[model samples]
Target: LLEYLEKDSFTKDEILAIKTEDAGLTEHLEAIKQAYGFGYDSISELIEELEGYLKSLNERLDYYLNIDFDGRSVVGDDPDNLDDRDYGDNNVMPKNGSIHGTHVSGIIAAVRNNGLGSNGAANNVKIMAIRNTPNGDEYDKDVALGVYYAVDNGAKIINMSFGKSFSPHSDWVRDAIAYAAKKDVLIVAAAGNDSKNTDEGQYYPNDQIGVGEEVGDTFLKVGATTYDYGSGIISGFSNYGKSSVDVFAPGSRIYATVPDGKYRFLQGTSMASPLVAGIAALVLSQYPKLSAAELKQILMNSGLPVVKKVSLGDDAVVPFSELSKSGRLVNAYNALIMASKISR
Candidate 1:
C-alpha cells in the first residue's frame, strides 16, 4: 500500500481532483490521504513518511535473508556465552542510524514542557538510557547484562521495548529479571508486534516462566492500542494475549524523539511499553515507598477497561476483554488517582 503511494508523484489536491476510472485506485488514494492527513501543504510530509516505511520494510527483508547476520560480531563477544560480560563500552547511543532506543527514551522522559518536541508521559523523571538492543535481533547475554546494569545503577524503572521469537539463554535473562525484582526495580516490556497471540507463542524477556507461572511480580507486558477508542481499537500489528499482555497503551502513530533530536511518528508495542513505563514513573514520583510489585498492581487494577469488540488481526474479531490479562487500557490520570489514594 505504501509502495504504491510512493510511486505516485501527484499532489493531494491533484489526486483528489481526478475522477479515477478504477474504483480500487480511488479507494486506496482516499485511504492513504485519510491515514496520513495528506493535503496541499503536507504532500512532502507524506512522501517523507512513506520513505521511512519503505526503509523499515527493506531492513526487515534484509534481516530475514541474511540468516548468518550477527550484530554482535563487531563487539567480538560470544553472544551464546552467558559469562561474557566484559564486552561492550559506555557508548549507549547507536553507532549506526538506528533511532529506536532514542525514540523509546523520549517516550519515557523528553524534558517535559520545554516547548521542544513532545511531552513525555511522566514529568520530573530522569531517563537512564541503555543501549543493549542492536539494529537487528538482540543477544540474550546483552539483555541480561543490561537489566543488571540498570538495576544496580539506581534505576528504579527499566523499559525494555525489544523482544525476540527465540531466547537461547532464557534462564540468564530470567535470573536478571528476578534480580531486578528483588531490588524493587520495575521492568516494563513490549508484547511484540507479530499480531499473534502471545499465549500461544513465546517472546522472551517476559516474566512468565511456564504455561501458568510468573517469575516476578514487577514485570508488566504491554500491548498496542490505536488512538481510536471504539470498535477496531487495537492496532492491526500488535501482538496480544489474554494471559500474557498486561495492559494496552497508545501506540499507533505515536510522535516521539528520534536520533539527532528529531521527532517522528512510529508505531509498535515498543512505543506502548515506554508510555506505561512513564506512567509507572509518575506513580513512583508521588508514592516513593511503593514497591515495584505494588506499582505493577496499581497500574493493572487502575486502568480503564474496554468493553467493545475489537480486531485481533485480519480475520479475528474478539472482545477487547480477551486481548489482555487486565482487559484494560492504561490511563495515567486514573492511575495517578489510585496512586494518591494508596499513598495516603
Candidate 2:
C-alpha cells in the first residue's frame, strides 16, 4: 500500500501521516494497538498481518518493474501489430485498485448534488471508460483504438488524460484523431507531466501532425495550473509550450473519486486535461449546435490570462504568456458566457 501510495504521487511523510476516516481501517488499527498492549502472541498476529501486506506489496512492485512481465497473453492480441484490433475484455473499471482513470473520469463527470462525494465539473455528462493505459505505459495502438471506439460510439467529447514520451505508431493515432475531427468529435488531451517544454520535446497525440503546423483544430492540448494565481500559478510538474499547449486548468491537489466508490487527492496534467474536457462538456450541454472546432476556439479564446511572471522550473521565471499558446487559464464560467454569445 505504501508503494502504491508513492506511485500515486504521495510523499513519504504524507503517506506516514495519512489518516483514514474509514471505519474498517480505524477498527483494524485499534485492534492492532490492542494486540500490542495484550501479549506477545497478539503482537505476533499483528506482525504477521503487516508482513503479509508488505509481501503482497513487494510482489506487486516486482511485477510493475519487471520488463519481462507480459500480461498481454490474457488479452490474446499482438501489441506490436496495429492490425490486430479485436482484443481485450469489457472490464474497463480499474484493475487492482488503480484509480488514475477513475479520478480523471470523476473530475469530468461524477454525479453532482447527490449528497455523496465531491461534485464533478459537468453534471450531465456520461463518462465512457476506455482501458487503454496499463500499469507501466500505454500502447499507441490502444490509444488509437480508444479514440476510434469513442467516436464510433457517438461520443461528442473525448477526454484523454494519459500520455507517453514515445509513440511507435503515431500515424495510426493521428489518423484516428483526424477521423474524430472529421466526425466533429472534440478531443481534449493532457500536455504531459514532464516539466520539459513540449514545443522542444515530442508528446504524442498532439494536433500537430508535422513540424510547425496542426492537422486539425478540434484537438485541445492542456497544461496543469494551480488555484493560486500568482508567481506559483503553473504546476511544477506540468509540461508547457507556447506552440503546443493550448490552455491551463486546475490540476494541483485536485480532490476526486477513486476506485471502490472512494475519493482522493491527485495532481498532474492528467487532472488538468479532464477539467478542460468538463468545461467543454458544459459548453456543449448548453450549446449543442457548436462544432468541435468552435468549441475548441471558445475554450481557447474565453480563458483568464495570467499576466504575472511564474516559475517554469527551478529558478527559471518567465511570463505566463510564454508557457502556452493561449497564455490563459481555463475558466468554465467565461467559456459558458462565450458559448452563450456564440450560440446567439
Candidate 3:
C-alpha cells in the first residue's frame, strides 16, 4: 500500500478519505494480506474457492500490465504490417486472433514503447514466431523443426510456451532441447500446466536429465505464479518438482494479445515462459555477449525469494525454501541488478 501510494498520484488527503471509507480495510488487509492467503481444510475446497476468486479477478486485472511491449503483425493479421509476411500453411503463421502466441510475442518484443500496448522486458529483440504448437498436444516433428528453425535463423533465445503430458516420440523433442543447448541458444520451457510435481514422472518432457543432485545447465523449466507471494506459493494448478522446475513467474491471470486484433486474460505456464523469455531478452539486449548458460545463472541467482511458508498440494504450509531449485520467484528488478554487475 505504501509503495502503491508513493508511485501513484494518491495524495495524503485522498488516502485519508479511502482509509475513512473502509473502516475494516486494515482488517481485510490483514486477512488475505499479500497473496490472498487462505486456510482451507481440503484440496477440493481450496480449488473451489480459488477457481471463483481467480475467475473474478481475471475479469478486472490486466495480466500483461507489467511487461513493456506493443503488438505487431508478423503474419495472420497485423494491420500495421500490411502484407509484410505471408503466414503459409507449411509455416505456422501468426494468427491475427491467436491470444496465446500474441501474448507470448508481446512479452518477448512487441515494439517497445509505441504508446500503444505495454513494453516488453527487452528493449532490443527480433521475435521469430514459429507456430508449431496447436490447440492440443504439439507434434514432435513440429517442435524439433521449431527449435532448429530458430537456431538456423539467428535466434539467440527461443521461448517455447507450449507442451503436453504425453508424446509418442519423446526423444525427438529431448534431442531438440539438447540441440538448442549445443548450439548455445537458450531454450526456456513451461513445466506443464498440471499443478503437480513433475519429478513424479507426471511432468512429461520433464527436465530430469542429470537427476541425482545436479541438473544440466542447458534447460530452465518454469512453473507459473499468481499475483501474491506468501501462501500463494504456486498456482492452484501448477506442477511442481524439487529439481525439475527452475523458477516461477506471474502466470495466474496474464493479460496479453488475442486473435482478431484484441486482448484478454489467459492462464498457463505458456504465459509464464514468455515473461521469463522477455526478461532474458532484456539481459541479452544489454549485454549481447552473455552465453545461454550465463544468462540462466543470472536469472536464477537474481530472483526474489518468498519469505512466507506455503502449502504445495495441501494446506500444510511448508517453508518456501523447500519448493524448487531456487526458493526465489523471478524478479526482473533483481535480475538487472545482478546483470549489471556481471556486465561490468
Candidate 4:
C-alpha cells in the first residue's frame, strides 16, 4: 500500500483518488500535497502504505541503497572511486569507502537478533542512503541538497554524522533544514569530535543560528560517549557544549557495519549521531504516526542519564552533568520503555 510520490505517473486528479480507511489519511495526504506541490517532487513508498515525497535533493542522496531502515553503518563514500573523481583531501578521509557511514549505520541499524556484534536501535526500519557527503567538509550546497533529498525521499529521521568548522553558505543549509522542519523531518547531527567546548568553538550547520527556536521542532545535535560510565565516559574525541550538544551515545572503539561487506572499530561524533538516528528510525518504524518534532523530544527526554563524574579529554575532567543537555547516553531498551510511557 506504500507509494512514493511519482507525480509523473498520474495526473493531479488521479493522485487525489488514492485513499486510506484510517483517520490520519487526510492530514498526511494534505501534507504531501503541500510539500510536493512544486514541480520535480517525488514520493517513495514505505511500510504501512506510507509515502515519502522529496524536492531538490543532493547528488549523493542516491548513494544509500535501501528501501527500509535496517540499521546499516556506512563509511560515507568509496575511497577508491573518490580518488578517481579527484576530490581533494582537505576536509575528511574517505577511508574504506564508507567506514564512517557504515560504522555509524551499524550502530543505529545493524540487523538485529541475527547474532551480530550489536543490535541496532530500530529493528524493522528502512534505510535511505543519500551519498552527498565525502571524506571531508561537505559543500554547503551538497549538505543542503542532501537534507532536501532525505526529507523528499521519505526519511522521517535523518542523521548528519559529519561537520566542519568553516562554511561558505551555511544559510542555504539552514534554510533547507527549515524546509525539512516544515515537512516534519527529524534531523540528528553530530557534535563535532573535537574534544572542545562547542561554546568556545562553534561548528557550522548547527541548529542554533542565533535565531529563535527553529521553524519546526525537528532538529537534534548529539555528542559521543564511551563504553564506561565512570571517568572518561565522554569519548576523548567528543565535543561538549551545554548550549549546543543535546546528548551523547556510544562512539569510541565501537564496532558496526562498514563498506565492502565488512565491520570494524571506529570513533567520532559520526558514530554517535547514527546511534540517535537508529533510535529515531525505530521510533518512526514502530509508530509512524509520531511527528518529527515529537521524535526529537522523545530522544532528549528519554536518554539514559548517569551520575558519574567524567573526563572529557586528555586533561579536562569535568563533572559530566554540565557536558550536554541530556548528560546521558543512549539506551535502546530504555528508549522503548519511555516511548511506551509517553504514548499514554
Candidate 5:
C-alpha cells in the first residue's frame, strides 16, 4: 500500500491520512499484534516490524503490476470471449523463452538411458503442449480451451502445473474438467506453492467448487514432498489439506531438462504434479483397459502411507495424514501393481 502510494505520487500528508483512515489496515495491524504480541517488547517496535512486512507486500504487488510483457497479441484472441476458441496457432513455445513448461514436460517423459540428463517417470509417452499459462496469471478462457484441445487431440491424461488464488471465470475451467471426465481423461494439477491450507483458501482450477464437494472424480490435486520421509517430509512451500489436495509426490530438488538443451534442478508442486501425471500415464499404458476414475483411485490408494507429524506453514505441526486426502506419497511401482490387480 505504501509503495502504491509512492508510485502514484501521493504526498506525505495524503499517505498519512489514508493510513490513518484505512479500516482494513487497522484490522490487519491488530491481528498482527494478537499473533505476535509483546515480541518486540512494546507496541511501537511491533508496529515497526509490521511496517516492514507491509513494505514487502507493497513491493511484490508493485512488481506484478509493472510487468511489461504482454502475451495477448501472440495468440491474437479476445481474452474476454469464451466462445472464441479457434485463435491460438501452432506456436506453443513460451513468449519470454521461459523453461518452466519444458522442465515440466521433461519431468513427465524425457527419453531414458541415452546418456542424457535423467530418466523421466514414464518410459513411453507422447507430449502435447497447450502453452496457455504465462509468467503471471492466465486467462480463464485460455485454460478452459486448453483442456478442450488436449481432450480432443487424444490426450488421455492432462497435466496442469499452474494455479492462482482467484478465478473470476472458474465455471469455465470447471466445465472443461467435467468435459475431460466425460471423455475418460484424467487431470493432474498442482495444489499450489503457498504453504497454506487449501481448504481455508482454495487454489483455482480445482475439482471442488466448495471444500469436499468434488465436481469430478478424475481430477487429482498433488502436493509437493521432500526426499526426507520424516516429520518434515512436506515441502515447506507446498499447499496442503486433507480435503483439498489428493496426494503427495516428490518435488524438492528435482532434476529435469530445461530449454537450450540444458538440464537443471528445480522444485515446486509443479514438479510433483507431473511426477504423478507420469505415473498415471505409465499405469494407463500398462493397463489399457482401466478407466480414468479407476486410474485415479489406483494412484491414490497405492501410495506409501505417511502417518507421522509434519511441519506445515510457518511452525504449525499436524499429522502427515492431514496434508492430503490419501495420506500417502505417490509410488509408481505400487500404483502399477494396484493397476494390474484392478485390471485383472
Candidate 6:
C-alpha cells in the first residue's frame, strides 16, 4: 500500500483509481479526512496518515482474530440461558453502521414511485425491525427470541436473510419455527452463500430435521439466482439442495438501500430472501385468509420454471430443477395469480 502511494503527487483520477482498488482503504482515507481536514497539503502527509491507519487496521484485525473478543460481557446474560431475556435494549437499528438489514428491508418494502431509489416488491407491507445479528455470527438464543418477538408482535411474514454453518443449540430455533407455524406465520430464509449443496450440509435456523424431513410447511428456503435466464442463471455463490432449498430468487447485483440514507447494489442469498419475503407479503395482503403453509406452497409451485442446465460453481453445471425442491424462480406475478386461484 505504501509502495502504491509513494509518489510526488496524485491527480483526482489517480486517487479515485487507487480507491477503487480497495473498499477498506477508501473508507479509511475518508475517515482520516473527516477527522482532520478535507484535502491533504502534500503527498507525504497523505502517505503518513495512510501508513498509521493501515497499521492500526491490521493490529485491530489481528486482535479480533487471535483474541477471544467477547462483546456479550456487557449484555450481562448467559448465552446458554434461553429464558434470560432481560438483556439487550430497544435499539433495533443496525449496530456499527451495518447496511445489510437496511438493504434487506428495502428489497421488501422501499417506497414505490417516489423516485428515491427503486420500487420494492411489495407496497402494503409493515416491516418489523429485529436487530439480532451482530458483526459476526449471531447467537442461537437471540435467533429464537427474535422469532418469538416477531411472532408475538403480529409479524405475518418473517424474513431471516442471515445464516451460519454451526448452531450448537438449533433446537431453540426449531422450536421457534414450530411456534411460528402454529401461529400461521411464514418464514423465508436464505439458502446461504457457501456455494455448496445444503442437502449434503447444514445451514443454521433451517426448519429441516433431515434432507427430506421438515418441521413445518410454513418455512421456505430460497437460493440465489442471477438475472441471466440461460445456463448461468443460478448464482455461483448460492447454496442449493434438491430437498433443502425451496426456490430460487434474484439476488445478484440487487440495487437497494444502504446505511446513511444511501443506495447501492449488493449480491447474496441475503438479498434473495427478502425478495421472496416481499412476494409472500404481496400474496398474503391480497388473500389474508390463506394459511402460512398454503402461502409457502403457492410460492413454491407458482414460480417460473427453468428448463435449462445452470452453473452451480467451479465450472460445474446441473439441471436448474435439481438445485431446489421447487426447481423454479420465484415470480411475483405468478405468485399473485396462484394466490388468487387458491383464494377462489
The most accurate candidate by TM-score is 1
RMSD of 4: 21.6
lDDT of each: 0.83, 0.82, 0.67, 0.69, 0.83, 0.84
RMSD of 2: 9.7
Error of 6 at 274 (Å): 0.3
By summed lDDT, the worst window of 10 consecutive residues in model 6 runs over 34-43
The TM-score of predicted model 1 comes to 0.88
The predictions' CA RMSDs to the true structure, in order, are 3.6, 9.7, 11.2, 21.6, 11.8, 8.2
Give the true-structure RMSD of model 1: 3.6
* Quality of model 1 by C-alpha lDDT: 0.83
- Which pairs of residues collide in candidate 5? none
lDDT of 2 by residue, 116-175 (tens): 788889978888877887664567788899999999999999998878777778888888
Between candidates 1 and 4, the one scoring higher on TM-score is 1
- Give a tens-digit lDDT track for model 6, residues 86-143: 9998886655536778889999999989989977889978989988866544789999
Give the alpha carbon lDDT tens digit for every residue of 16-101 in model 4: 77766655766777766764552223443221112111211221244233234222124244332312223323333355446566
Maximum-lDDT candidate = 6
What TM-score goes with each of the models?
Answer: 0.88, 0.80, 0.70, 0.69, 0.79, 0.81
Clashes in each model (backbone N, CA, C under 3 Å)? 0, 0, 20, 42, 0, 0
Off by over 4 Å in 4: 1-96, 210-215
The residue-by-residue lDDT of candidate 5 on 192-262, one tens digit each, is: 98988999997988988769678788999999998888888998889998899999999876889988898
Where is the poorest 10-residue window by lDDT in model 3? 63-72
